[model samples]
Target: MITIGELGEKIVATWLEPQNYQILHHRWHCRWGEIDLIALDNHNSELVFMEVKTRKPQNWDQNGLEALNINKQKRIYTTAQIFLSKNPLWQNYNCRFDLILLTYIIRKNNSNQGLIKILNSNQIMYENYIFTIKNHLKNVL
Candidate 1:
């Protein structure tokens, strides 16, 4: 099963596609840490290193951007540097760090109203759940 964080990344990628961003990598990891998404803006020839934070609607005390502290920023920058060093072709592109915050509302349907049954096992049908993105923030750092 796909985790909520992974699902959020997909939603963010989908949101970025129409805006001319081509995803180069997702979950790129190095000794420093992992970059949530690495994308190139075809329209402006800029490299984007993104940090994605996914939170359920009721779990947030602050905006996701605020969660990226100085230490996290340092780690992300170091990782980006490593990425640029390993990929010389992209070294010339202007790079920027961005933060994407996704807030999802997950609804469990116990009633049959507006619920789609996907499977039937022992005469028990699985109700469809909905995941909705409530907010997205970009270029926070």
Candidate 2:
């Protein structure tokens, strides 16, 4: 079974696909850390390194924002540098760090009457959870 975090990453990738973003890598790792998603903007010739966070509404950490502390950012930065060193083609492209935040909302309504009304463009209703894209912070790091 796919973990919640992984599922969130997949959802983010799917969302980006329609916007002309080509996914270069997923879960790229090194000694420092792992990057959840790496994508290239076909329109602007930019490379994006994304960190995806998935969480429930009632939890702490500002829905995973607080979890990305200074130390974690540094590790991700170092890992990005390592990735650049290995991938020479993408090295020349403009690079940026982005954060994708997703929230998992439990379905409270049994009837389908309000389901269509509740969902917006950035939300998806899965089995028993509604995954919503809470925020997309570009050039975060």
Candidate 3:
């Protein structure tokens, strides 16, 4: 099963794809840490380094943006530097950091003995799940 973090990366990647962003990496890691998504913004000719935060609707106190504290931001910035060093092709492009916060809500379906039905053919114990982009902040760092 895909973890929540992985799912969030995919969701953000999908959202960016339609907006003229070409994904270069997902979960790119270095000695510092992992960057959720790295892409080339075709529309702006910039390299984008993104951090994604995923949480249940009830888990966040003041939106997920608060989770990207100073230390986390520093780590992400360092990681992006390492990435650019390794992938020199993007070194010349302007770079920017972004944050994407996703809120996921899962609703219980008690109609069929706790089974959630979908499309009248698929049934899942965990169903009626919805994901929304609670925030997308560009140039976060």
Q: Give the winner by lDDT.
A: 2
Candidate 3 C-alpha lDDT tens digits along 1-141: 989788767767877776799999999999899999999999989999999888887774555778899999999989999998998898899999998887766667534442322322111122355567777789999
The C-alpha stretches of model 3 lying farther than 4 A from their native spots are 108-128
lDDT score of residue 131 within candidate 1: 40
Local accuracy of candidate 2 as per-residue lDDT tens digits, 1-141: 889898778777877887899998999998789999999988888999999999998678777888889998999999999999999998888999999888987777546542333356688665566888888898889
lDDT for 42 (candidate 3)? 95
- lDDT tens digits, residues 1-141, model 1? 877687667667766776799999998989999899999988988899998777766665454656799999999999999999999999999898888766655456556554333222111122333444444555655
Measured by TM-score, the strongest candidate is 2
- Candidate 2 vs. true structure, TM-score: 0.86
TM-score of each: 0.77, 0.86, 0.82
True-structure lDDT of candidate 1: 0.72
Candidate scoring better on lDDT of 1 and 2: 2
